[model samples]
Target: MPRQHITTHIAILGCVCLGLLAYLFHLDQPVSVYAGTTSTAQDFDSPGSVSVVVNKQRPLGDPGYVPAVLIETGGISLRQEAAEAFAQMARDAEASGVAITAVSGFRTAESQARLHDAYTGRYGTEVAESISALPGQSEHQTGLAVDIGASGGECSLKACFEGTAPGAWAAANAQRYGFIIRYPAGAEHITGYAYEPWHLRYVGPDAAGKIHGAGITLEEYAGLYEPPSAPPSSAPGKNAVEPVP
Candidate 1:
């Protein structure tokens, strides 16, 4: 082969190598780090696990499942792991001058049915579904979800609670304790629920961090639902700070 031809081939090979290196670098980017992230190093496929996702599209892993251990906090109960986190978060919020309290947690499937029926009866099926979960399809059934309010009872179980001090504090700090606002505003399309600032789901701190940092719902973090190209503009009730979770 001619020397000039051989030199050209070598140059082309060098360019190809550089291109491959660039591609690899792109793959190593921080956002690419999420390729390895799913409910904090665990995917959402395990219904019996802490990372399980319960929603309209999915139900608890086992219909008859109940937490092996349930702990109470302020008259509400959560699974052991979640209860601890819940207590810690409330304490931290109180230290910060925000008194938060849990209003509901660890519901039986039968209880969920009664609540759903009541809501459906009063408000119709559509409104009931937006706020209440069907029996086996509730995260509360997993003992990992809790609805909270201010200690003073300000805005209890109401969207206006977001404007309350306790609500503000939880919105900012819930992720630190392995919780996320399950139904964030503007994400109703993806979450199949309305914006409920008080509904918190504990998926573990590791998973919660990724979900909070990414400004996505658990379903989105789990690769279960794809957000729209342009998300709708739904203003979070009153105080809109920390709208991600």
Candidate 2:
């Protein structure tokens, strides 16, 4: 082969290698990390991220993960950012004559385990899994979830709450303040839980607004709603339950 031809071939090969490297680098990046994607606000995989998606299929990175800072709001504890947003939302609700109260928030993994155990004992593993979340899989452990209730405690945690003033108001307005109804009615298949009208998950105003506007769960919004490759196992003597929101 001519010397010039050999050099030209080598140059072409180098360019091809560079192009391949560039293509691989792009592939390694998260598609959602780019602007205009469904989730562009924050990291969805980090346990401490406001946009983190914690479902039965997607447990927290650390089973014992806790928020860096928690603040009390309406007698419940939430991460500082979530608490602040809730306070604002509460004030707004009260101003509108719809008093919102936080009945439960910021449960630890241990606390979740206790609740799960109690529910399992009463309802059996199958029913309990639908009503309650397992340890590490519960968003309440992230200090970004708050169970809202009426100030008068009417229909507090039951399905009836969705009809109450507080619940109705929050359903319509919580997204404006950076919260979403974590488990919506008729979405049990996607969220893995029954309708929890009182449960609100803070995902920042941007994400909350987008999710609310789209009428989808965080799992769907973050692209984590697919079935796991392997089914999750339960404790000895307990039947494996489906994933919960």
Candidate 3:
């Protein structure tokens, strides 16, 4: 072979090697880290990674007040029949002596923004950003979520009900009521928000059972649904942060 031809072939081989190295480097990027698991670490590592998907409904407007009495003292009024079923499940839990209650129900966009601002006020903008979702980003805006507990007390804003008996009971039996924990501990990697045991999302009995039984985040189960909607607002009523049993 001619020397010139041999030199040309060697140069081409060097270029190919450099190209392969660059590709591997790109694969090692932080975003690529998500490729490893159904629950990805990078998904919730930062605020920008969190994104809201618009489903059956558009994002909500400012959240109006629905007297706390209506949600906590009175009863959790639900627009969807599935929500009513959830209330019924709470009643059944009450029979078991669990004493379930709704702490937070439907929340409006403005209400959610206020809550977020409050958290940020105390916890700084960046940290607060991770712990709380923006108004439109919150499931509470969707009115499908209800924070449950042992009794009606202050639970909204931020409460780690996972440790209490009622919290534990709800965690165990939420599926029966068509409710899911939504965000479980250790899954901060998958869910952008922190672990919220009291946050129960109503997706119907079958979905709730499957999600709880499978031990996965709503984001993952979201794929099972034909389409996914936004999260619900604070309790469908007025504030005062009541605990959901």
Candidate 4:
């Protein structure tokens, strides 16, 4: 196998092994209950739904579908609720001296296709698939996923952004505003993408809080999938812990 592929495989295994150890260590504790208990299959299956789980394994319920309503905020369009929530999150972040910028949102199927094609051309199929979602399998098509950046443009869209003011702030607080770092670090294998600190997906406050609080992926939260092990939650205030890097 190629060196990079081998490295990635090792990283994935490391995360799972760490997570299993954490789960075992915390076996005496009760796993947190999912707050979004009412979420149904349609919630994760419909593109227009707030809790939709579009990914490589689950394509959009309807291809080429457009959201019923989209609203522009920070020069990017998103579903109405998501736009409003993001706007509030930005406002609060700015009040705390963290500047948040929206780099992309609400892509059409044609746009996603072009973006995927571009990545595939530059990186080849396997790498491209890990970095970019195919057209109908993208969360952006639902207008709930947004790529964020810092106003100063430092480390924008880069992994290093996770350490930047905006990125750190969002990672710690986005869930309070109904969003999550969709493809979080250490969960690339489960998420089917690399760690993208700039990618925030809104799943409503209830779902976001539960997922964030538990330190698990949407697949695990929605009962679609689970990694062999779970790392404890590292978020400061959350009681649920998982073993993670």
Per-residue CA lDDT of model 3 for 1-245, tens digit only, reads 99999999999999999999998876666531111233212332221212222221323233342323223222544435446666677777778877777766766668778888998999998878767667666666555677665565545435556666678788888788777877788776566667788887766566666667778766655442333466776655765567779
TM-score-based ranking: 2, 1, 4, 3
Cα RMSD to native, each candidate? Answer: 11.8, 11.6, 18.4, 20.0
Best-first order by lDDT: 2, 4, 1, 3
Candidate 1 C-alpha error for residue 28, in Å: 11
State each candidate's clash count.
0, 0, 29, 8
Better-scoring candidate (lDDT), 1 or 2 = 2
TM-score of structure candidate 3: 0.59
lDDT of 2: 0.88
Q: Tell me the TM-score of model 4.
A: 0.76
Q: In candidate 1, what are the lDDT values of residues 1-245, reduced to their tens digit? A: 99999999999999999999998876665431334563324546565577888898898767666788889987998998999999998888888788888899999888998999999999998899998989889999889999998878988888999999988888888999999999999998988899999999998998888888888888878777854578656777676677554
TM-score of each: 0.76, 0.77, 0.59, 0.76
- Per-model lDDT: 0.85, 0.88, 0.61, 0.88
| Candidate 3 lDDT trough over 10 residues, lowest sum | 45-54
Worst ten in a row by lDDT for model 4: 32-41
Q: How far is candidate 3 from the true structure (C-alpha RMSD, Å)?
A: 18.4
